[model samples]
Target: KKTVTFFLVVLLAVSLFTQNDMVSAEIKPKERSVGKKCLEITCTMTYTTQQCSTHCIQMGYATGDCLPKEAAKPQPPEYCCCYFEK
Candidate 1:
């Protein structure tokens, strides 16, 4: 009985954490982009800030940065977040 209760509590905690990650994964363009629109490009390799900016320019965005996934845990993938005129 005690074991079952402990297991249920652990499961609940895990579920709550996963739900929070899902919520925070949503992109808020206005808050993060300032006056511009933003795009997230999946980054498979390590990228420097300059490289990310250059890549964004090549893709026709005004600017960009290599940023980690927002509110993520356990080594989230990085992304090249590019900004452009709205």
Candidate 2:
């Protein structure tokens, strides 16, 4: 009887998790843009955002989206990971 109860609880938890995942799922665009080569570059921590932007253009991208890297530990002078299309 105890084993059966544990099994039922586990089953319920799994089912709830699956339902929550499905509810939160959304379709994503297949491609943000086509026929463009996308390049992702991470600038050194010493470089500022403005520098990164300049570097992006020099790397052959018209523009860039620069953001910091996400990590499990605290980071300082956050690095910029820029993505652009050539």
Candidate 3:
């Protein structure tokens, strides 16, 4: 009986220790749609993504052209980064 109790206790301890590696603690970035494309555009300006969104809307679906792969990153870079689909 004592041997069985020891084995059960050992098994429980091993399972608990093994589970810690599977747990995670990281945040994921959010992706938002710009117009009708699958690619995205990012703008930097002022603060908050909301501000950048205004700029994105101006060139909206009417010109949902995907930027060249070699195009530079958006301006204002500090914040207000918006994404559009390609």
Query: Can you give the TM-score per candidate against the true fold?
Result: 0.41, 0.34, 0.31
Superior candidate under lDDT, 1 versus 2:
1
Name the candidate, 1 or 2, with the larger TM-score value: 1
lDDT of 3 at 51: 45
lDDT of 2 at 30: 43
TM-score of 2: 0.34
lDDT of 2 by residue, 1-86 (tens): 99999999999999999988877775443455522232344555565567766766777665444454554653543554445533
Candidate 3 global lDDT: 0.48
Number of the top TM-score candidate: 1
lDDT of 1 by residue, 1-86 (tens): 99999999999999999999888887544554333333466665666667888988898888887666563562556676776765
Ranking by lDDT: 1, 2, 3
Model 3 alpha-carbon drift over 4 Å, by segment: 25-86
Of models 2 and 3, which has the larger lDDT?
Answer: 2
Report the lDDT of model 1 for residue 5: 100
* Order of candidate numbers by TM-score, starting with the best: 1, 2, 3
lDDT of each: 0.71, 0.59, 0.48
What's model 2's overall lDDT?
Answer: 0.59
Clashes of 1: 0
Q: Cα deviation in Å at residue 18, candidate 2? A: 48
